[model samples]
Target chain A: MPENTQEGFIDQQKVLDNEEYSIKNTQSIIQKAVDWFRARSMFVLAYGTGCGAIEMPPIFTSRYDIERLGVVGVATPRQADILIVSGYCSYKTLKRVIRSYEQMNEPKYVIGLGSCTINGGMYWDSYNTIKKLDEYLPVDMYINGCMPRPEALIEGFVKLQDNIRNAKSEAGYIQYRENNAFYRANQEKIFGKNTTPTFEENFAGMNQ
Target chain B: MFNFAMTPLGNLFFGLTLIVFASLLLIKNERRDLPLHILLFASLGVIFYASDLITLFVGWEIMSWSSYFIIAKSARIETLQKYIIFNLAAGFALLGAIVLIVAFAGTTLYGEIDFGKVPEALRVPITLLLFVTIAIKSGIMPFHYWVVDTYEESDHIFSAILSAIISKAGIFLFIVIFSQIIGYRYLHGSLFDILAWLGVITSIVATFKAISQEELKRLLAYSSIAQIGYIVTVLALLEGSGIEAGLYHTIIHTLVKLLLFVNIASIIYITGKTKFSQLGNLLYDYPALFILLLIGIIALAGMPPLGGFNSKFLIYTTLLEKKKALLLVAVMFSSASAFLYCYKLIYGIYLGQASGDKEGYRELPMSFYIPQFIAAIILVLLGILPSLGIALFNPILGSLGFEVSSYSSLFELHTAFASFNGGVLMGLFGLVFALILLLVTSMRSKAVKVRDRYDISYCGETPDPQNNLHYGYGMGQELRRISFIRVILENSTATYWEHISKLSGDSSVMVKKLYSLGTQYIGLFILLFFTILLFLGVR
Candidate 1:
């Protein structure tokens, strides 16, 4: 990581797929069974960040019937599994969304729902919305569209479920733990001293 | 003359409440007003054992005044005024009923004064007056404005007693007066119907009110009102099983409140915070208290394998037996919403994230755990063997002039429409619980335990310890947006009661002018008296 003294921030020159940052899950029979069930039953916390939220209702309702694929919407983060960041997240929304995501239990995933989450879509020049979702948090999967249709959303769910089942890539929650320092550094750059809690300052002594 | 008689209903409530009082004695709090607690309990005994209206009235007055003084010790002026005013009004109502009964029957003794001997028109008024007194004490709707304030302002330990045992004094009075004094034939009409409706409405409204409360004790206060509402509704059936169900529920509520309030008192004693927003994440530091509260909530929500479920089961069966589908549905709705507040009670104090500085908290004394464990164990035993409760109530039911409903065994409880075999229910619940526990433990190796509580999935940002992460305060705030709930939550009888108080205040001020010694005022009073006399003479 290169320090950018001019902006007092880290230079984001390296791709997120740095080999040193790769995370993996241990393969076992019980682990496979657990992952299969968890993949099937995804409780999505569909946080509507931008226009993409308009597309979620149809996917959840009779048109798509996402419930058939064992994906359901929950009211609280305590019971949620997958958090859907539905388009570009403003700094304010990002703070709350991060808070909601942290409240969720283990074995959780994040899905960057639209093109804005990829490169801030049309608002890349806006002062608020972050361009890359993965810079502040782990993005387990991303579906491409200005606003993904219900069909595309369902397809995204399918691909994510397949990834979860096969353990094909590092899970977002595991990466969050192993490379938390990097993510926290990026978050602090955007949020300054007001960033969410740091693991070292807040939680380090408590973990015995 | 001191005359005392024991009935099944009275014995059951008095004995169970005595158990609660005994449990209270186990707590070694600084503000344990031991003498007042004893006075309150002894007065309850007097009310329950009274064979005459005079003795009941005496006992009632003692109980009310003792509790008022206890509350006055730490309560604010406004809270004390509300408490005393309502209680005094209830005391007057009871006295008026006694006077009316004496005027008609020419005696105060229960065995001597027969409702049949009284004039037909006087019977309804007498019953209603007595009903009003009970309603006020039990904190029934419209008459319940004083309860939350009193509960909130009192010492937490005393709040437990007030909720657990004192409120039940009204139910005891109801059972004795309605069943034995007034008799069912006089009450098989619109009067009891009004009471039944009032009870259900109170529960529905109180359940919603309880959900919106941010203060822990105030929430429990509303919950107490709701639970007592169910008992009142059941008591209105004027049937053997209905009374039994009411008694059963009364016992369960007493135990649940005692356990919960004491557990909360322990938390408050340690942390010195009363609002849900001010407290959080004490589960690890006080894991035992957490489990105790969990048990309290489990029973309070009336889940299986606890005495709460047994009582609720009885209440449902009685309602169904009476063919009250609508009432049953309303009761179920209230029960369902109760889950939200019950979850809040546990989640607010223990789980989620620590909201404020918990460093100031210290270890709770062992005295707190003694009462909690006692209540928890009894609740479990009653859940496992409900027959014990029925057997105790059988003699009381027989004494209440109703045929004792027989159980097949020590563990089976049967009603006309349904039966609950406690042994079987307990066995099945235990078996399923054990299997799930075994299965979960077997897979424990595969499941990674996140060592850090703060190490939760956040979109990609870390969570600040200072940030308000515990949703305890906001848990039920959104319920206000629901149309039906909004209607109930927005409309309260407080304004009506306030108007009544203002009216009385104005009348008292006008009367006070009559005592003015000014010449003009005195001459005006004389002129009004002569004018009234002249008008009467002309007529």
Candidate 2:
């Protein structure tokens, strides 16, 4: 039941309800615009970790033309919105890849781009390679193949774009922010004390 | 005869004055060298004001030696030797040109130079001599070997002046000698065409060289070379607007270098480090300096809403007006590539994760901020009021005998071919910046500040603070992998200079052997001297 309480003969409940509704509407509209732009323009910093990088050129160049979908390759993480981990990450490459990912600005996404990244593929028995890309970086989607074809890569991008627009799932960045300790602990198991700088978040609860 | 004149004082002087004042205020530690800096300033004044080549040369020598002594105060023996050798060579070149002028024209007065009287055979050599002098002093391309070491090894404040003011002496000489004394008619020949090409190649190569440097100040040194290269290319245009455009850029470069070098100096002073790898995440410690550097680089990159863009705009227009399409393309390419070094500079110093020990780091002295703030305000003002720079240069341009550039209005800076309203541009930029900033902030419920400097996103792996994550040293290292850039990096003037040095050393050793007083050697010398004399007599 809705409370029909009045304060000093004024309809305070009605006023509060109206204000909340307006604020919510404004926030939602702004959010929608942000999400639309984020989906429309994606600057990917493609970290070629393994053989999967072989497939990237065909998709980005004249043949597949990723730019047609507003996805462009950038030189640095600072200007990029997407970090495409395009194969198996050795412990060494993982450090640099993570550094690159962290350097990118906010509203960023990660796409695990090959079977090696998904489950180590042929490198499953290897001493150097890591399995399960999401255990390290927050991966929004994974494209499975020994090396994904250009068509498969394009399809993955389209799906990622749709997911971004509809907000179908929790964004990887938010997930990482919420559970960074879990990621940090797993990363520490391999890298030990030599890991990249800690991603610090000052929690209000901690302050109290 | 020495003649001194200082009118049409120009944008260059205006900028020089600002930097001098800023440096004076900024210098707190080096009280003794204040006099030397002042003397350099006075000599530069003489060079700028001189009405004759003799007076200009005198000022140039004084400026060079005073700066040499200041550099020697802190520089290594090798660096000092390189500094003196290159500068002395430049000095002799200027002297040679002046002698040629006096012999040909029979006058030392700048305005009295009758280039028409100079024989066509001699004109090119004289101009070439003067161009060499300018190139060596300004550290243009192949002659730029001395600049990096001297800049890297010098006292930081002096480095600021060396780059900001001393380098401009070359541009001053070029303007006074080539554009005014030699006249455009003689310069329109193949000589000027070669100069234009040299400037283009120098800028392109230096841009890559700057990108490859690991040391912070060395990067700035190479950047200085590249910027001066553009000025050289424009000055080679020998057109009305080209000279004006050069002066405008000269002023902007002066301010930008002063701001950037001082910002680095402050960082160096605090940390006692000059390499990029040694410094990182300073933004948290010195946000103000970071902001100043950002402003400096924004202008240096020639982006709009800053004074740099106005000059760059004028330069492009001047090149376009002359229909130097390919030259324009090359210049544009060089300018476009400059963005990498500029990014590397700011990033190396301030951004990314903290890589160094933060303990014992003190705030930069109040004196350091003085220059940076002044430059920042001026850059912003010039961005909004670009015509102020043009208006400042108008009298100088008028005095130089070029037609004064006309603007559509006080707010719109106009060349013969193009025009832009700086005021409108600034207003639009401000409005858009505000809108975007507001939009970004309102979208967020609250900010998630990083918990620690080390807390960066690593692949599920924790980053050990011990591991170096700052990409400062390696930022542009990949550029060398490009085939064209690879060739450039592989072929350097080091080998050429090394060969010359070796040849000189070997000849000196042989001469020393001849001088050694063995009885047999003395008798042989006497015989050889008599033989040479007998041969001359017989002839």
Candidate 3:
């Protein structure tokens, strides 16, 4: 087999035409463009749960004016590309996060807020708190701080945009979807069992 | 030996092995309900002992996942999702920081990666990463969502372990980076002040939140956040005394939370009623248990003559010396709030109106009660003799190389505690209190009436048939007075997060428009691809 870095080897093998991007310089070039566009495409989801949520106001409205950078906040999961787990969750909130994540479409990203969501922060020992957020779903970025500073959050935004632009994720959403059943099952497992009348009715009727 | 992979490896391997063993020997077969806890503890322990960054991270991640599974196993999937989302967010942030640090540090080894070797620019970001991870785990304000829900929904004993042990991961990480690697000197001490407010505000908000909750588990959860706020506040101090106070609080909180959760366990098991609105009049059946609960609640409330008071005193003294006046006020306010909740806990569960007519409310298993019993006794013993727990914890602190305090003068309050003649004061106060109580009793007539329905929040209306009104009790009711405080603590951050999700959805929508006829997106992608190639060629 020819070395991947060597032109003679890869060209001769003609390994399924899908490998075309790997051999070309265009991928890097295209990435640069994506990043350029991503930098300007500033819309953010304000998924505040913890104290980190506190910093967003100054950043978005007055102090930092993240809006100047093209970042405006959104309101619903369906309309969002980024899901921020602003703080830690109990068994109860985890269910809603899953539902929200399910509602989000492709090319989605998740940003965690505050230290609590990171590893239960200080409540790491609390029997009610989950230690980390990533056990159940994918995360794209994390804004550090018990509640991250507005600057740090801005930094997080830039880093995410950079990742989005640079990632060689030209492949369709099929790969992302294949492993999502665990998420669905996880969502079902929690939602299916809530005894609250509102949810109970949904569980009984929605399954059919 | 404590390599990056090793820590997570230890946790992952041990977690699986224990789960297997629990399934085999403990339950002897298919899906025994027991393996859940053993797996949780084992995984958590291995993660704690993890030696390096990646391994520690991996172990931490896996343990978190497993614990989330345990909590979600309760079937309250909504809370589980919040739990999962919050944890994932923090985990990703930690990972981003770790990845960046590794990129700069050139290694993932826990000890080998020296911050000094890295470029000046990267150190603050790395410290921020570690700090954030710890803060999230610690349930510092804003980050404290998952703790309450998971605690409320999961098994009572599970909540106990979670509150007692797993939560320390945040402190462990804090110690790892804050005192150890970062040196707490970053950004010219500016960040410290922010962290300090983080603690103070969180304390105020969380305490208020705790006071307002009605459900036993939810109340416990908020209380848990308030306690964690104290710990974070101490860490923000960055002084030896402050660190000591924080560590001391950690130790006390660990004991107090364990006992409290165990007490909760006993109640949950016996009555199966989880909310304050549902439970009542348990003192008649379980006198011994009620006494234990009282002690636990007292200790948790930071009342005198208990372990809670000693630690609270230390924290209060430290804050005062640091001159964190607002925090001082917050601490006192939170304590006062504690009295209300603790009173509600007792009255609502054991002294208020009983919900059912069940004559046979049997006691929980003796095994289940053992933990609570041990916890309460220790709380009392530690309260009586703060030196005992302090002496024991000192060695652990020493081994961890934490600098101990020599500030005898700091704790000396409005007249030195040692010199103020505490014994004499106690005797005088006891006599005054007793005399006052005796006078009040003598003054009261035999026809003094105390009715159940007269409580103010409950006074508003009767139990309506259609919608059971949730009388905003505790901090919830109190929040109504301070509505303009921006005191909305629910995950309102999602409004913006969802907006971002929408943009991504919009991106997909745009792509769909490009290919709505089943070939738009694909064709556009192709057209865009070729257009770029041809344009570049033209250029």
Candidate 4:
């Protein structure tokens, strides 16, 4: 890769390193205990924006029984802790996906599912689909495949749980909150100024 | 001759009327019928204070006619017709009973007239007549045909009056006539039992009907019927405690209905919408009204830590003391199912997604909040001091010749079976609620208010303004899936009344045939009628 393209990759590594350092330095016994509890319970709101939704039933049901790993599905974004943005994100679908992601309570995480969500997979060159999901929404983990199996999905969940428990990676929610302008700018490039409601002050006339 | 006295029972009802009327007047907007409102108030005073049947009948007639005119201002022609017919029938029944009393006992005075002086043959007819009058007024089953329409069609403020004050007149009549004048000895135990069953059945059926209502006022109208049914059941026991229970329920229901109706009236005033489907997501827009409504419904549902629970507690204890197990069970069933409608009421107007545009809604005037605030404060106070109402009722009970219930303190609501501490219950609940609120607010994870109302998770599909997101109309629709509820919802008293009307129409048509006959036939029929009358008179 040329030096210019590698600069973006290098910057991401630096952000991850800073996150790890901060986690090690600030985590007290109570903080670690809190993180452990948070990791033990996860309420997932599976968006299933595209083809990847078919794999979720087996993981939730008796076949995979993902509940054994302390992961469960919730009905609304308000109660959810993790939002799985599964498969391709068309311009229209991305608007709702952004909306659902914003609705989740804080300390939230987003998991990008399938190669479609990673880089649009087979639809990478399509005008309607976005190539990179992370530019619009901060993706904590990306399970890249045309269609990830139930086993791969569960493995992704376990790894995400480990990352949460150990504070091994930068949380997408925190990055989204801190660098909201960057994400908002990218989203606005496609949806214009009215892109999935602004995070800035006085938005919707809400004081807080 | 007319006689009027402020007896304790009368005083209690008069006080309730004053409170309800005062609150209603505060929020009333239509100023055109002020005189008529005064007439209605004055009539209630007459009915309550009258010591003689003649005076009471005059007051009752004035009340009926004045209310009829008031209803006529806003109601449809059919509604007006139904109102007049029902009130006329009620008036005739009262008149019939009074005429019998005056003829047989030679006096209509409450203290002077003796039921024993009346012939045994006439006593049953008098009791039945009085019962018909009371049953129709109180919206008891079968005779309750006219209530729902009248309540729904009346002016909103007048509807509050109808539910809160006017309906209680029947209850007052019951206490005065059956318990005091005729005396319980003249009434059969089986008759009271039947009455109690009728009350419970009315409550159960009306509750199911309330759940299926689409309009806000219609639901409330049904709810008023159901709540009154409870009072009727408890009062039918004819015990001192039962009367006490009924009175307590009466007071709580008055306050709750006033609060709810006023809150809803304000919403209607601001939004110009009456159907639940048209109103939603108003909690943020009108927090005060929402909280008042919450208090109202919480009490209306007979939940703990509210005035409604205190009354329900007293009623249940009274039933348990009487060992009316089946009636108690039925009452409990109705009370439990009430939670569903209560939830629906709240969810429909406040908690769900907004169903319509919000740009047009304006803030209600300060006058609208006055009644709601007063009612809410009183409800909370009653929850803290359960025996406050009992203490008030004690004098009335004694005056009515029933033994007064004893209570050690205002906070403690004592009964034969059990007693609960209202202060402690309220304090405990307040503490828990406060703690939970504090914890949620101070939590590390903050609530992110969505920027737009349409920003809800819809399986990755954006909800459009045209989409019906509110659960208001659909909340209780699924209750029909249950076989028993299906049966209840499917059958309506309106259908039965319609059938009766059709039957009466057929009978009238057959009678009309006689008028169509030739002059010679008419003359022969008149002669036959005179001959039959002479034969009966001679016998």
Give the C-alpha interface root-mean-square deviation per candidate.
7.2, 6.4, 18.5, 4.0
lDDT of 1 at B438: 94
How far is each candidate from the true structure, as Cα RMSD in Å? 7.4, 10.3, 35.7, 3.8
lDDT of 1 by residue, A1-208 (tens): 5445587765443323454543365679988998899888999999887888999899999978999999999877778899999999999888777777766767789999899999889998999889999988899889989877888899999989988997867789887877878888887888887865533533343233
Q: Which model is ahead, 2 or 3, in terms of DockQ?
A: 2
Error of 3 at B461 (Å): 19
Q: List the residue pairs that clash in candidate 4.
A: none
**Candidate 3 whole-model C-alpha lDDT, 0 to 1:** 0.64
CA lDDT of each candidate?
A: 0.86, 0.84, 0.64, 0.88
Ranking by DockQ: 4, 2, 1, 3
Query: Which candidate's DockQ is highest?
Result: 4
Per-model clash counts, in order, read: 6, 15, 96, 0
- Tell me, by TM-score, which candidate is best: 4
Each prediction's TM-score against the native? 0.78, 0.75, 0.58, 0.89
The DockQ for candidate 3, computed on C-alphas, is: 0.01
Model 4 chain B, TM? 0.96
Residue B17 error, candidate 3, Å: 19
Local distance difference test, candidate 1 = 0.86
lDDT of 4 by residue, B70-89 (tens): 99998899888877888899
What is the full ranking by lDDT, best candidate first?
4, 1, 2, 3
Which of candidates 1 and 2 reaches a greater DockQ? 2
Best by lDDT: 4
